[model samples]
Target: MKPPCYLIVLAFLPSFSFCEIVVKGDGILQDTSLTKNEATPTKPQASKPDPAGDDLILFDNGDVMHGTFGGIQGGLLWERKDIDRPIKFSIPAIRQVVFKGSSGVVMEKETSFITLVSGDRIPGKIVSLDDKSLVVKSSVVGDLKIPREHIKSLSPNPFDGELFYSGPYNSNGWMILDYRKTKEKDKAKEIAGEEKKPKKEVIQENGKVKEESSAWIHSGASFYSLDNRALVYPDANMPDIGRLKFKAKWKGRLNLTLALHSDFTRVLPAEKKEEPKAEEAEEIEDGEKPKAEGEQKPRKKEQPEKQDPAPLQKERLVDFRKNNAFQNIAWINPSKRTHADMFGTGYTMTLYSSYPNLSRNYFSETGVARTQRMASVRSNISLSEGGDAEIEIRYNRKESLMILFINGTYAAQWNDLGGFPGDGTGFGIVNNTSNARVRISEVMITSWNGMTDSANSMIHPDRDLVLLGNGTDRFSGQVIEIKDGVALLKSAYMNAEIPVKDLSKIVLKKSTSTDLDSDDLSEDLTWAKEPMTIIYKPFGKIRLNPISAERNLLSGNSPFFGEITVDLSSAAMLRFTEGSPDLSDWFDDL
Candidate 1:
């Protein structure tokens, strides 16, 4: 059979002539024309001022363009101010797009979210439900009748409370600072003491000096860090009981530090005090009596007592050092190390990836405190090399407990024996890898009830699972119907009507053929002429084969959802390509 007409037309496109697209294991798309070198420096050059436009597109090689979205047809059409004709980009050449002024959909009071078996999540109010199909009233895309077999779990109150933040829409208020540079400055100050001249002045007095640049680059909705750097959201007003969710993609080993309840706007070095010499200490202790004899005590005239600069006063320095809050350092793969600290108390967790993958956790409360081994088990939560994972952290300061979930699996939980430290509401992240590239996006913080999912619970292979609010109560049953915020479940012992608010999660019986894994979905997309993953706003993802587009609507065919049309405005991101690098090769090369 001959190729499609659009493919024939795409062959003649001018943009394809000079641009060579390369897709990385982390799903980053790079245009060789925009990048002169494939290797990134240990400390990258300072990023230019963000371009000005209503919409922005980020290329994989850290290049960005300010333009207007021209919608998607056979490929993405981006209209630029410098060009009269719209430039079409293949899916593999674009990282992400940020639509200016696009806010998250405001969910109604009665709204709930459903997670499909294909990993798609949709927010809507349940109209009615049965074993065959679920009718839902979506505020954005109108009513949707989702097949019952595709349903995985349901959340009655996904947010639990109002949404606090759902962005990384732009880098407007974000502070990206080079971690190494700040530490170096702090070290230099500590060694040189307060009497040393300022670095800028010293440079002027000596010779021209080079200034360090930030290791992170912000393009559109994502932040890419070349070396160690800290991305801080100083304005975050974290709820006492809240959940933080973000998607991170990185190349090479994943080493990251997540700080919660942090008040640190910028890194502040710890205060250092010099010890007095033996004679100086004795003379000071002796006061004016002993100093009279032959010492003289430099008594020409008593000038005003010298004082350190205002910013370096003892009280001010102490206040600055106190801003360092709870932080978790997580390193995956070869390192297989994790550490969490709050104030002076914390724990270190080590992991082994192989069979009997024994993990250990050791807690320390103080220097003289007894060491405690809280818990240890063989965990299956292993992060592959050069792979991406979704990291979710939920903290309940009221309960002094924090839970971590990796790729939807319960990894571990920690209870702060010293109680949750710091009342500050800021959140921050540090890229701990030296030369690897890290990309962070889709960051969202929302008020939570501080409940953990039942991913660790045991479930019968043939029965549907229902978990209660307490995080431990659960049962296996057949879900007959769901209505009026109550789930009707028929179990072996009795039929119960469980209130939705009392439930934490519901996992339906898996269908062998209907439930498609992500790997399976990616394999099917390989055959499509133009395959794209449309990440809808609020929540949800759908893989579609683009047929055509008109105005703001994109009509496409999903192998799983069949014929469908998506409003371009309702989408948060559009991914053109998928797949991770081979794990064996990555490990061997490392």
Candidate 2:
């Protein structure tokens, strides 16, 4: 009305050149020139090339780099071969650092392992126990005084049985077999005629020929499988009565099949036997010659064929599923064999994600031939995706029982009337889902004493709890006092004194005077507004705020436990949570 429309547009044209509107991936338009000094946008620098090094650094975005770790002060300092100077990375942006060829402290004798309420397990000798605190002498930290309220369980003789295997310390003797390649090879054979065997790629190194396939990435104390592959520990000296325990963390569904007492090292095709010709069959029958139409033949007792003495074998007294009481949800016939079937004459425990979770155990008499579901249980605990679990399987052949414990709680047990199967002393794990990624650590196999672990009792918020040695033994009352290895309980029925050695676990009543919430009481320590988590070797994890790392010693202040120092060698990994200003923001400043 006052000026023409063209005149108004011309007035704002000069101001438009000062600010450039940029649309980001989030669909937000940003005035770049107004916020930044330059009009030209800076491109992100390319990631540095990985160098040949032992230590590995994992970032939050799943990028990994090989470098030498210098140490940590305010942040971590890493040295890369391609770079002349050491690079400093913010702690919040790093996932973990894995040191190759690093073995933690080894305990020579028997030790007591204590599981804390926060889920950190400490291996040490119990120094003293009382109503106030429990003192333990650790090989790594010397001694630690833990509060009674923080302890979840105490195992006096954790390593009571003979240890057949305890490591995964490195990727020296493990075998990773990729099933996808096998499927592809079979498909190629079907199209190119079965008479021609598919050629396989082989590599020659150190005067030896080896076949190449998918391999599990060994990072410090863990083994990671990106694709669905089977990992086998061949020729393991497994005992008849033994225990298998390991910790597994995964992304997406954790579909895993564990094989115990397996006989085969690798999956083999079924051997086909040709039928005898009619003429040959008639000649064999004629040789028999209708043994004496009327004459009685002298019976001769033939001596058993002499053969090399076999290893100690146990007789199968009872048949599994003798009565067939439990309903069979699925049946695997002898004719059908999948690539996932990697073992012969053993037991397979499958873990599924579908609810009633459908955790099942199946036995195969001859590989996939005549496989039957022995027992199945609908797990009450939900193993959600992207979570972790501590799984334990105890097999007692003498007792004809196999028990499963998840996260220290008794889950289910299977009885085998047919007795243990297979003479092979090996174990294997197969990932059933191709899209899922799995990480396994802390693999331990040891002899069992034919006794199942007691199931932990539910903690009552109002009353003190005590669980005894037996699975079902439990008591709820106000704990009067604990002195001289005996606990005094005052209940409405009676005031009883029980020996602590006979008790499996004890949960004390919570105090009401604290202003902090119960959940806040267990919060991990924080530094620079970022939480820190430390993983220990064998099995253990704790959270604390690191002050400094020098001379291979990490000093930190814990929220639950006060100031403490731990050897860096004992630590398997360290993780940090993101802060307000992350590494991406720091990069923008440059």
| Ten contiguous residues minimizing lDDT sum, candidate 1 | 327-336
Off by over 4 Å in 1: 1-52, 58-63, 81-96, 178-213, 219-222, 247-254, 265-385, 450-460, 468-475, 483-486, 498-504, 511-513, 517-530, 579-590
Best by lDDT: 2
lDDT measured at residue 124 in model 1 versus the true structure, 0 to 100: 70
lDDT of each: 0.57, 0.57
lDDT of 2 at 272: 62
The number of residue pairs in model 2 that clash at the backbone is: 5
Q: Write the per-residue lDDT of candidate 1 for residues 498-583, one digit (tens) a residue.
A: 98777766777764225354555555423356466666556656667777765467777765556777767766656654443111
Candidate 2 worst ten-residue window by lDDT: 324-333
lDDT of 2 by residue, 359-460 (tens): 222234333344556664435657898678888888876666777888887776777777776566777777777777777877888776554643344545
